[model samples]
Target: TNDPLVVFTPSGKRGRFAVGTPILTAARQLGVDLDSVCGGRGICSKCQITPSYGEFSKHGVTVQGGALSEWNSVEQRYQDKRGLKEGRRLGCQAAVQGDVVIDVPPESQVHKQVVRKRAEARDIVLDPSTRLYYVEVAEPDMHDPSGDLERLRDALKDQWEIENVTADLHILQTMQPILRKGAWKVTVAVHLGDGENRPRIMNIWPGYYEGTVYGLAVDLGSTTIAAHLCDLQTGEVLASSGVMNPQIRFGEDLMSRVSYSMMNAKGADEMTRAVREGMCGLFTQIAVEAGIDKELIVDAVFVCNPVMHHLLLGIDPFELGQAPFALATNNALRLRADDLALNIHPSARIYMLPCIAGHVGADAAAVALSEAPDKSDDLVLVVDVGTNAEILLGNRDKVLACSSPTGPAFEGAQISSGQRAAPGAIERVEIDPVSKAPRFKVIGSDLWSDEEGFDEVIATSGVTGICGSGIIEMVAEMRMHGIVDAPGLIGSPEQTGSDRCFLDGRTYSYRVYDGAAAGGPLITITNRDIREIQMAKAALYSGARLLMDKFGVDKVDRVVLAGAFGAHISTKHAMVLGMIPDAPLDRVTSAGNAAGTGARIALLNTAARGEIEATVRAIHKIETAIEPRFQEHFVNASAIPNAVEPFPILNS
Candidate 1:
């Protein structure tokens, strides 16, 4: 006679088990992701499952009665003390009596789905690299002559089915004391190795370790360094922080930094030290914010552009500065935290995503991973706007990537009366088409300049200056109101029919706010400021157009802006300036900090590392410097809203 048939729901995994077999045992045999913290002793209550009765057609299983054994003493005691939900049974204690169907709830699954910011985006499942396992080792015996470490390894294999486990020298030295302290029972944090690594023990606790380990996902950008501290078990973000890159003292951009390294003898080493010091400071700040011991951070992942990648790894970036732009290496890296002088766990492992090209580095690969353009059916264009822009255009069939040198103007560096996106910076703007009068909103206060109670709100963080987003809107509004001409020239006050426009030297300036009497700088938009914005936006549009030419497509179905500045910039203004190709306004949306999200994804799911590595290989890289049409596109894009391209959607 055949034994009872067991079928698990949601995964559709089926198996045949003996009459006395436990549900938890069957789940483990079938490789289901049911969680258990207390080694199935009914203490943690993490393996609760609900069984369904009277299933007729699916899996050919039917249950009339007595499909599961009645609740035992341990379960009864647990229910009496803690109270289990109705229709719930502990997988550990419930024995199969007949053919049965089990439904594992989302809460019981070890890898639960974490929803992304956008509803349409794919959800990330929690499958962390490191995990905790509890084991009971045999006591040392003089007759057996087996070492304590050998017994522990044997226990792990016998109880948890883990084999070929290794440990560092430090773990070896401390193993004896910890084994005796826990009385032969200990909980070990193991890094479940990937293709290139073997399973190794990261840390050990005396007995039944209750605390969870942590991982750091860092997005190392040229302008700033950002980090997120996350819990490995639950996939929760504990704290988020950022600090300036600090290498800015050497140079403002990548090429400038490379030049500084060439001009100065010790410039490369000085920059390497500065960036590492800044990173350590950021790690400490975040660890303090999360109120956790730094030693608990067991894993970390970093994503960055090529120059920053080279600098972080202590490689000189001279190769990336010259023609052909060859990188030192383009493969993913795995190392220990101590190797990089990071003060996390002494043996904490770090993974860096692969770089796509010499200029299109791992940051672009991170954006592709987060957006998953290769998986999309519709043609999509993803633009990560920053000091240097990374553009990707692709679909399910193929994908293309390129990098453009847009400069630091977009970050409010070169523009006059500009500042970073801090409190009191003007972030929103509007201008009346006929009168050319302007009203705007700063970052701290939500009220418009003309609204009541606006003065009170401004008393604290007075209007300081305009930011990147503010500059985009300021230029776009000027074009829309006929204040700035198509050639990026501000008309005279009489010609523009507005007293706000006045001749400053030979050219004209548009005054948005005149508060000099109130001890505030006279905030105005100069002709040179218009020229800087024109150059920045033109470079951005030129790169996108170059990718379009290679793809043999006239227009993309959708556009996704993926950066901090992209998240806040006005889509209407971007279209007016022709910063991006013309498309339906509704189809253009923002994926806030896509590169950072990708880093978090890789941190939480180890399998994503291989997936992005494969995707990077398949992607085709286009060099914008070599493309002849790039210069042509730049010239046309220099004019406000393009000199040749037509925006039918915006005109309508």
Candidate 2:
């Protein structure tokens, strides 16, 4: 009765399916695998598509109107700079009324995530205070009277270049048995430097062989949890897996969880358990795939943003969300599975990377570590863009960090047409302003049947929404073409007669109703959508500028963008919109989830845990709330993109 939902996917395949289905549902029906981060709740914005023709229907639930507008700040800029245009719907939010086709852009973290790309350099630098290694004497038999203790010291001296070895209470108790079992071959594991010269023997494997050990680095993000199984010998990531951060039930943003924690202690504990369970499950699955026993996972590293860090440690996060924004702990902790209720080898060491401040948590530390800021002399700026954007700047000499509440704008929380990045969602849009024509990409095409159309695409995963990235692109595009102005006014008086940016007398009320344009029935960008983007970009830009001001650098030698946005962001577009500072396009690099990378580093080399902590200490955090400069920066950063003005690159 209707044209099928035509869809194209990342694999370069195309398919069509019948109506009345979500994208993910259709994906599974056709034996396709599309990862949905929001679990089909229409939140993650991971599944996105471009629909050619289809009816979009919803239950008509009343969403708060004032929260978003047809234009205010964000939209005008989006239209002018990014070249985004109408019908750039989040895959989860839009439904198919008829035949529609779409494309999935390369930037979306859908289908898969960007892995931690690490350099294979083992010129390891560990904190002398925390990393410890001791060689114990092998028990000399009747033929050899050197004694077990003496043999161990000799091995330690020969290998570790240490004159003396220290043993802890637990190590002392088992030394004799260990010597007997291993024929006097013992390796003591301790923080690199032993103040007492006593090293704890983590394990007494038979024989005197030195093999690479494995560790896991984990980034416990509020929306996503990533674990990198790494090799300790040469510092390499072996096998890694990432899943949704399981804490979404409490609320989407960190503030919700913090408020919940303050209200109910039991709620806090439950939240902690949820994340721990998720992390443990991922750990077990990854270890099995890596051909390693559960016990082989000895050391683990973890770094989470403030609230997530608190939830993972069972610490109260209430203060972090409110005035005086306090943190429960800032020092690095050496813990065991029982401490955090994590399921791992019972005796394995757990290192939680230190947080710099209440808002700027360990995620920043992970970013700094992954980029190795101390090794460089050129200025560098690190921006971790998420619900909360934490920024940092410096070279090898000095580094300054700050946190900005970017809201959930980038993640598409408050926008009207926003949906999780998923199938049936219009992931990428290339619009020609003069012709008012558009080309789009969707998530799933390889799995659709020719008979069906938008229904098959929408059914893929029951996709119901759009996310932050899509919103940014859309807002930028709309602003650039004069659909919206610098102040977010819907339509200009000059283009009054036939202008269709708004309908129904509302600034953003244009409705596609039934048969509409190429992508199907849809109202394009709204005034409120523009404002949401303005706030988000402002926060990111403000944070970057503030850090630059602190360090007195004009243009950073390198700009490292971190977190979800980092995986795929156009440096040129980002600079044009002033979302990030202007620099050589190549100088702006993406550090795919540095928090996860730091976690992997901790997992692979437990001793490095101390090093990471010290690095966090060196970092200085600028509180945007208290710092008047950030407020001023934010006010200016909030302006929508103007057609005539050049995007400013802040200098001292």
Top model by TM-score, which number? 1
How much is 524 displaced in model 2, in angstroms? 3.7
User: After superposition, which runs of candidate 2 have C-alpha atoms over 4 Å from their true positions?
Assistant: 1-198, 208-212, 444-465, 492-500, 509-523, 552-558, 602-615, 642-652
Encode model 1's per-residue lDDT on 1-652: one tens digit a residue: 4888888887888888999788999999998878886677776688899987765445555545438888999889889989899999999889888888888998888897755666224578888999888888899888889988788889878888788888888899888889889888888989988777888888888877879999999999998999999999888899999999999999888889999889988889999888999999999999999999998999999999999999998899999999899999999899888888888988899999999999899999999999999999999999999888999999999999999988888788888889999988888999988889889999988899889987775677888899999999999999999999999999988889999999999999999987675567789999999999999999999999999999998799999999998899999999999999999999999999999999999999898999999999999999999999999999999999999988898899
Model 2, global lDDT: 0.62
lDDT by residue for model 2 over 316-340, one digit each (tens)?
Answer: 6767778788888888767766687
RMSD of each: 2.1, 24.3
Clashes of 1: 0
Estimate the TM-score for candidate 1: 0.95
Worst 10 residues of 1 by lDDT: 57-66
Query: What are the lDDT scores of the predictions, listed in order?
Result: 0.90, 0.62
C-alpha lDDT of residue 365 in model 1: 91
